[model samples]
Target chain A: MLRLSNLHKRFGQVVALGGLSLHIPAGCIFGLLGPNGAGKTTTISIAVGLLAPDSGEVDLGHGGTPERAEVRRRIGVAPQAIALYDDLTARENLDFFARLYGLSGPQRRERADALLARVGLSDRADHRVKGFSGGMKRRLNLAAALLHDPPIVLLDEPTAGVDPQSRNAILEMARSLRDEGRTVVYTTHYMEEAQRLCDRVAIIDRGRVLAEGTVEQLVGTLGGSSVVTIQTDEGDTRIETADPVGELGRRLAAPGVRGVRVERPDLEAVFLHLTGRSLRD
Target chain B: MNAVLAIAIKDIRLLLRDRMGFFFSFFFPLLIAVFFGVVFRGGGGGGGAGSGIPVAVVDLDNTAESAAFAAKLIAASELEVTTGLSPTEAEEAVRIGRLRGSIVLLPGFGEARRRPFWGEPMSIELAVDPSRAALASMLEGVVTRHAFEGLSEMFADPAKMRGQVRESMDQMRRDGSLPRAMRPAFEMFFNALDSMLQTVQEDSAGEPGEAADPAQAAARAGGWQPVRVSTRAVSARPSGLPTNSFALTFPQGVIWGMMGCALGFAITLVMERTRGTLLRLRIAPLSRMQILAGKAVGCFMVTASVAATLMVIARVVFQVQPTSVIMLAAAIACSSACFVGIMMLLAAVSRTEAAGNGLGWGVLLLMAMIGGGMVPLEFMPGFIRTLSVVSPIRWSLLALEGGVFRGFSMAQMAAPCGVLLGIGGMSFAVGARLFRPD
Candidate 1:
C-alpha cells in the first residue's frame, strides 16, 4: 500500500502536480485514468522517489521511517519508456537487475530464468532486445519490473504502443498480480481497461483527481440512467431513463415502433458526464 | 560492491562488442606505429657508417691540383659530395638548403701553394647555413688538416729547412736573449745541422739520376701536390638509444592508443545518460557514487589493456626492447588513471553525446599534438616544448619512455608517476563536482 499526501511538483512555469494526493489500497488493481499530461506519471515518479515532490511526503504503509532504499526495495517501477539496454539479451538484462536488487549467483540465475519463462520469452531470452518486436519488448519490460517480486508494482502505460495480443497479455498480468495479493498501480488513457481490470478507479486531470470510486458506484453518480432509442416509420426517437428495458416495453406499446435498443452508461460515458469532457482529451 | 562490479563488467562487455571502438582503440594506433616506423627507419642517425653529412664542392682553379683535390673528395667514402658547381651556384645551393655547406678553391690556389710560407696566402672559403654553424666549423677543421699536410710535404727539402732555421736563429739572437745555459745548445745545434747538410749533399751526389731537391722528389711522387679535401660525418647519431625509429615512436603510439580509450569511454557515459539508462540506475537501489565508481573502474581496465597490448606488439613486431617490465606496468597503470579522470571531466562538461564527443576529441588531439604524440618533442620549437609540460600526455609519454629505454632509476620514475597521479586526482575531483545525475 502507498499513500501520497499534498504532492506539489512544478517544472519551470508549468505545474506538473499541484497539491495532488491519493491512497492506493493493498491487493487491488488501482487505475489512475487520465488524458495526456494529466500528472499520472509525475505522481507515480514521486511515489517511486525518481522525482521529489516540492512539499509532500510518501508513506509506504510502514511504521518505521520510510527511507528511499527501503521503499525502493519494496516497490518495482516499469517506467513509461522502455528503459533497457538494447545490446544485452533479455536474460542478461533480468540478471543484471536481479543483482542490483541484491540477488546473488544461483538465486540470480534462477529468478532470471523463471521470469523469462513466465513472460513467454524463453525462446528468445538469449537474443538481444534490439531485435525484439514491440510486443515482445513490452512483455520483457513487464517481466523485468516484476523480477524482484516486490509487493508494490507501478506500471505507467506498460502497453502504450503494444499490439492487441500484448495488450491483453499485459492486462491479464496486472489482474494476476492483484489476485496474488500485491498492490498494483496502473496508469493509462484507456477507459475500457479501467472498466475491465480495476477494482477501484480515479480520474485525474491537470494534476488533480476529479473522482474516485468503484465502476458501478461512479456510474451511479452519473444519475444511474440508460439511453433508449426507438426507430419508427417516421424517424428515430431517443430517450433517457433509469430503466432501459421498462422504457422499451412502454415505447413498444405505442404505434409504429419498429425496433428498440437499450444502452447502459459505461465508464467512458460516466467520465464524460462527470467531467464534461472526453477521457481521451 | 557487487552492483558496482556488475556495472563495470557490463560496460566492458558492451565496449568490446563495439567493433568500431575496438579498431580505434587498438588496431588504428598499431597501424600508425608500423607506418611511421617503416618510413623513419633509415632516417635515424644511429651513428652508423654511410650516414654522410650532405655538402657540395666548387673547384674554380681548373688546375691539376684542384682536379686531384676533387678526385680525392670523390674517393673518400664518408663524404657524399656534389661537385662541378661554381662558387655562386654552391652558395645559392647552401642558401636554399640543398647543401649543408660548400667548399671553394680559389683560382691561384696551386700557384700560391708552390711558394711555401709566402705570397698572398691562398684561403679556401667555407660557405655554410647559419643554422648549421657547428657542422660548418667541423668541416673547416677537416679542410685545414688537409691543407697542413700538403704544406708539410711541400716544404720537406733539407736546404730550405736549413735556410729557414738560420734565418730564425739570427732573428732570435738580435731581438731576444739566449739563456746562458743554452749558448752551448745553440752551438751544438749548428754543428749537427752542418753535418746533416753534408750527409744530404753526399746522398744527392750518390743518386744523381734522382731529383736534386727532396721537395722536387716529393712533388714527383705526388705527395707534395695540393692535398684534395673532403668532408663527412664520422657518425650520424651523437647520443641516445640506438638509432631505431620504432623505439622512439612506439611509446607515443601507445599514448595515442590509450587516449582513444578515454574518448570512447567519455562518449559512452554521455550515451548512457541520454538513453535513460542512467536515470534507471539512479532510481535503482544503488547509490550515485557506486555508479560513477563502476564506470571509472571500467575505463581504467580498458585503457590499461590497450597500453599493454601496444607494448607487446612493439616488442614483437618493432623489436623494441623494454628495460623493466615492472616499471612499464606501473607507468601504464598511472597513465590509465590520468586518462580515466580526463574522461570523467569530458563527460561532466558536455551536455549531450555529440558535444561530449567533439569536446573529447578536440581536447585529446590538442593534448596529443602538444605532448609529442604525432611528432617527437625534439623537433618542436623552444616555446612549444616548454608549453608541453602542461599536457598530461607529455608526462605519460615521458614516463613510458623512461620505463622502456631511458633506464630510469626508482627516484627518476617517481617524478612522472607522481605528476600523473596528481593530475588524475585533481581532474576526478573537479569532474565529480560537475557531474550531473540527469
Candidate 2:
C-alpha cells in the first residue's frame, strides 16, 4: 500500500502537483489516468523518492514517513523511458539491477534468468539491448523493475511506444502482479488499458484528481446517459436519455419506426463529462 | 561496496565495447607517439643521448697547433666533426644539408697566437645552414671554447708572462709621472716576477736551445705555444633508443592518451545521463554519491590502464628507459587521478553528449598545445613557457618525465606529484558540487 498526501510540487512558474492526494490499497491495480503534463509522472516521481515535493508526505506501508532508501527498497519503478544500458545484454541489465538491490552470486543470476524468461526474452538474453526492438526493450525494462520483486510496483506509461502485443503483455503482467497480492500503480493515456486492467481508476487534470472510482461507479455518476436512435420511414430520429430500456420500448411503439437502438456511456464519456475535455486534449 | 564495484565494472565494460573509445583512448595515442618518435629521431637539441651534431672542419692554417686543436674538436662527444675539407667544399656540404654547419680556420690562426696581445684580429668564420641555427650556435660555442683554451695555454708559461710583466713595468717606470709612493709597490712586483722567471730558467736549463725573445724561448722550452683556432661542423646520426626526442615526446604521448580517456569517458557520462541510465541508478538502492564515486573510479582505472599501455609501447617501440617502476606507477596514478577529475568537471559543464565532447576536446587540445604537446617547453616562447605552469598536462608530463628519464629522486618527485594530486582533488571537489544526476 502507498499513500501520497497533500503533495505540492512546483517547477519555477509552473505548478506540477497542486495538493494532490491518493490512497492505493494493497492487492489492487490502481490506474492514474491523465493527459500530457497532467502531473501523473510528477506524482509517480515524488512517490518513488526520485523527486522531493515542495510540500508533501509519502508513506510506503510504514508507520512514519520513510527515507529514500527505505522507500526505494520497497518499491519497483519502471520509468516511462527505456532506462537501460544499450551496450549490456538483456540478462546483464537485469543482473546489474538485481545486484544493485543486493542480490548476489547464484541467486542474482537465477533471478535475472527467470525475469528474462518471464518477459519472453530468454532466446535473446545474451544479445545487447541496443539491438532489441522497441517492444522487446519495453518488456526488458519492465522485467528490470521487478528484479527485486518489490511489494509495490510503479509503472509510468510502460507501453508508451510499444506494439499492441507487448502492450497486452504488459497489461497482463500488471494484472498478474495484482493477482499475486502486489499493489500496482499504473499511469497511462490509454483509457481502454485502464478499463481492462484497473480495479480502481483516478482521472487527473491540472495537478488535481477530477474523479476516482471503479468504471461502473464513475460512469454511473455521469448520469448514466444512453443514446437512442430510431430508423423511421421519414428519417432517423435520435434521443439521449437516462432510462435506455424504457425509452427504447416507447420509441419502438411509434408508427413507421423500423428499429431502435440504445447505447450506454463508457469510461471515455465519463472522463469527458468530468474533465469537460477529451482525454488526449 | 559491491554495488560500487558493479557500477564501475559495468562502465568499464561499456567503454570496452565502444570502438571509438578504444581508438581514441589507446590506439590513436600509441600511433601518434610511434609516428613522431620515428620521424624526429635525433633531429635537434631535444634528440636523445649519444647522437652528436654533424659538422665539417676546414683547417686552412695546417699548422701543428691547428691540427691539435682540430683533433680536440673531433674528440668532443657533442660534435661529429668532418675534416680534410676545403672551405668551399665544407660550405657546399652545409648548403646541401649534408652537415649541420661548417667551421673555417683562417691561414693566420697559428701566427696570431705568436703575438696574441697585438696580433691581427683573428676570425674563426662559421658558415651554417639557416634552418640549423640552434646547431650553428652550439658549433660556435665549441669553437669559442677551443679558442679560449688555446689562449689560456699560450699565456700559462711563467717565462713569457714574466717578460710581458717586466716590459709593462719598465714602461711604467720610464714615465716620470709615475708617483714616488707607487715606486716601492712596482719594485716589489718586479722582484716577484724576476724570481718566478729565474725558477722557470733553472728548470728549463736542461733544454739545448736558447732564444733571446721570450716568445721564442717559451716556444723552445715547449711551455707556451702559438694559439690555434679550430673549426669543425657537427651533425647527428640516429642512435636507437633513449633519444631526447623520444624522452620529450613519450610523456606528451602519455598525456594525450590520458586526455583521450578523459574526453571519451566524459562524453560517456553525458550519454548515460541523457539516456536515463543515471536516473535509473538514482532510483536504485544506491546513493547519489556512490553512483558518482563508481563512475570516477571507473574513469580512473581506464585512464591508468591507457597510460600504462602507452608507456609499455614506448618502451618497446621507442626504447624508452623505465627509470623506476615504483615512481612510474605513482606518476601514472597521480596523472590518471587528475584527468579523471577533469573528466568529471567536463561532464558537469556540458548538458549534452555533443556539447560535452566538443568542450572536452577543446579544453584538452588547448591544454596540450600550451603544455608542450606539439613543441618542447624549452623551445616555446618565454611567455608561453611561463603560462605552461597553469596546464595540468605540464605537471603530469613533468612527473612522468621525472620518473622515466629525468632520474628524479623521491624528494625531487614530490613537487610534481603533489601538484598533480592537488589538481585532481580541487577539480573533483568543484565538479562534484556542480554535478547533477538529472
Candidate 3:
C-alpha cells in the first residue's frame, strides 16, 4: 500500500498540489486521471522523491522509506518522456541501467536480452534509439523501467504519443504487471485506458481529486444518462437544440435508420456531467 | 574501478554517437593545435633557444676595414649578411621581412675612430626593425664582433714590430753608451714613445665604434658584455616554450578542456531534470546521489582522460615533457574534481539545459582568460595579473606547469594543489546543499 497524506506543493504563486491525499492498495493497477496541468506529474514526483511536498508525507507500502534509497530500489518508473539514451542501442541502454541497479555482468546481459525480447525489440536491440519510432522508443522505455524487477511501479503517461497498437500493448503490459502482484500507479488523461486497465480510478483536476471509484460506480453515482449518436454527411455536426435526446430518439425511430443502440453514460459522459468538462479537456 | 570504467565507456559511446558533437570535440582542438604550432614555428621567437636572424649591411667604409668585416659576417653561419646596401635600402629590406635587421656603417666610420668626437665617446647607429626589436641588441653584438675580429688581425703585425724596439733599448743600456742624467731624459722620451705606440697599436685593434682596444669591451659596456645573459634555470624552471609566462599559461588549456567536458554533462543533467528523467530515475530506486554520482564519475573520467591525452601529445609530439609525473597527475586529478563539482553546482542551480550550458560556458571562458589561458601572466597588464590569483585556472596552471617545468618543489607546490582541492571541496558542498530530491 502507498499512502499520501495532505500533500501540498507550490511553484511560485501556482499551487501544483493543494493538500492532496491518496492511498493505493498493493498489487493493483491504479489509474490517476487528470486533465493537462492537473498536478498528476507533481504528485508522482513527490511519491518518487524527486520533489519535496511542502506539507505532507508519502508512505510506500511494505515498510517503504520515503525519499530514501531503499524505497527507490524497490520501485520501477516509466516517465512520460523517452527517457532512454538516444545515442545508445536498446540493449546497451538497458544493460547500463541494469548495472546501475547492481546487476552483475552476466545478469545484466541476460536481463537486457530478455527485456528486449519482451518488448518485441530483440531484432533491433543493437540499433541506436535515435532511429526508433515514437512507439518503439516508448516500448523500450517501459522495458528499461522494468529492468530491476521492482515490486512497485509508477508510470506517468507512459503511453502518450504512442500509436494505438503500442498503447494497447503497453496497457496490456500494465495489466500483466498488476496480475503479477506489483503495485502499479499509472497517470494518464486517457479515460478509455483507465477503464480498460485499472481496477480503480481517481480523476483529478486543478490539483484536487474530483472523483474516485470503479467505472459503473462512478457512472451510477453521477446519475447516468443515456446517449444517442448519429452520423451524417453534413459538416455541421452540432446538436442544434440544447436537449437533443428526444430529437435523437425520434430520428432513430424514423424509416431508413440502419442502426439504433441506446448507450448508458460511459466514462466520458460521466466525466462531463460530474466535472462540467470533457475528458479530453 | 568497474563503476568508473562503465561510466567512461558510456560517455565515449554517447559522444561518439553524436556526429556533430564528435566532429567538434576532436576537430576543434586539433585545428587550434595545428594552427598555433605552425605560427609558433614560423615566428622563430618560439624556438626558445636561438634566433634565425638575417641581417643586411650598408658598408660605406669599404676600405678593407668594412669589406673585411662584411666578409667575416658572410663566413659565419648565423648571419646572412648582404653588402653594398644603402642605408634606406637596408632598412626597407628589414621592414619588408626580407631581413631580420640591418647595420649601416656611416661614411668615414674608420676615419672618425682615429679622431675621437670632442674627446668623447661615440656609438654607431644600427638601424633596425622595431618589430624585431628583441634582436636589435643582438645585431649590435654580431656587427661589433665581426668588426673587432678584422681589427685584431690588422694589429697582429704591429704587436710583433714592437719586439725590435725593445731589443735595441736593451742593447744600448747594457753597453753603457748613455750618461745617467741623459738616460733620465732618454727614459722620459722612451716613456712618451711607449705611450704613443700603445695608443696607435690599440687603435689598430677594432673596437668597432670605440677608439680603443676590443679588450676594453667590458669597461665600455658598464661592467657587462654584449654577450647574452644565458640562463639555466634552477628553481625558476625553464619551459620548452619561451619565458616562464608560458609555464603559467599552458595548463589552462587543459582546464578549459575539462570545463567543456564538465559543461557537457551538466547540460545533459539539466535536460534530464526538465524532461522528468530524473524523476523517473528517482522512482526506479536510484537515489538523487546515485544519479548525481553516476554523472559526476562519468564527467571526471572523461575530463581526466582528455587532460592525460593532451599531456602525452605535448610530450611526444611537441617534446614538452613533464618534470614530474606524480605532480602532473595530482594537478589533473584536482582539476578533474573541481570540474565535476562545478558541473554539479550548475546542474543544481539551473532549471533548464540551455541555461546551465550558457552559464557554464561563460564561467569557463572567464576563468580561462583570468587564469592565464588567453594571455600569459608575464604578458598581462598589472591589474589583470592581480585578478588572476583568485581564478581556479590560476591554481591549476601553477600546479600543473610547476610540475611540468620543475618550477616548484613538492613543498612549494603543496599550496597550489591545496587551493585547487579546496575549490573542489567547496563547490561539491555547495552543489550538494542545492541538490533536492522530492
Query: What is the overall TM-score of model 2 with all chains considered together?
Result: 0.75
Instruction: Say which prediction, candidate 2 or candidate 3, comes out ahead on DockQ.
Output: 2
Q: In candidate 3, what are the lDDT values of residues B265-316, reduced to their tens digit?
A: 7777776667655555565545456667777788788778877876776667
Chain A TM-score vs. truth, each candidate: 0.93, 0.93, 0.87
Candidate with maximal lDDT: 2
Interface root-mean-square deviation, each candidate: 1.2, 1.0, 2.7
Q: Is candidate 1 or candidate 2 better by DockQ?
A: 2
How well does model 3 score by local distance difference test? 0.68
**Which of the CAPRI classes, incorrect, acceptable, medium or high, describes model 2?**
medium
Off by more than 4 A, model 1: A63-67, A222-225, A245-258, A270-276, B44-243
Clashes (backbone N, CA, C under 3 Å), per candidate, total: 3, 12, 6
lDDT at residue A249 of model 2 (Cα atoms): 81
Candidate 1, residues B1-438, lDDT tens digits: the string is: 888888878888878878898888888888887787787676541112222445577888877876776677666544557887877777655543345567888777776666644344445777764323345566676566666654564243655666766776676566546776776688678668756654554554565567666544434433233443334322112233343567557777788888888888888888878886776677678777888888899899999998898889888877777666777888899999999899889989988988987898899999988987876654455467668888998889878866776555566678888999999988887887899866
Q: Estimate every model's Cα lDDT from 0 to 1.
A: 0.76, 0.79, 0.68
**What lDDT tens digits, residue by residue, belong to model 2 across residues A1-281?**
88999999999999999999999998999999888899999999888877889998999886434356766888888999889999999988988888888886898889888888888899999999999999999999999899888999999999999899998889889998899899999998888888888999998888988888887788778725888988888988789888888988887777898877777787788778887888878
Model 1 local distance difference test score: 0.76
What 10-residue stretch in candidate 3 chain A is worst by lDDT?
Answer: A234-243
Write the residue-wise lDDT of candidate 3 on A1-281 in tens digits.
88888899999999999988898888898889888898998988788777889998888876665577777877788877777788888888898778667789898988899888888899999998889999999999999888889888888898999898888888888988999999999999988888788888888887888788877677667635555555444322333433456868677665555554445666777678767988787
Model 1 residue A236 CA deviation (Å) reads 2.3
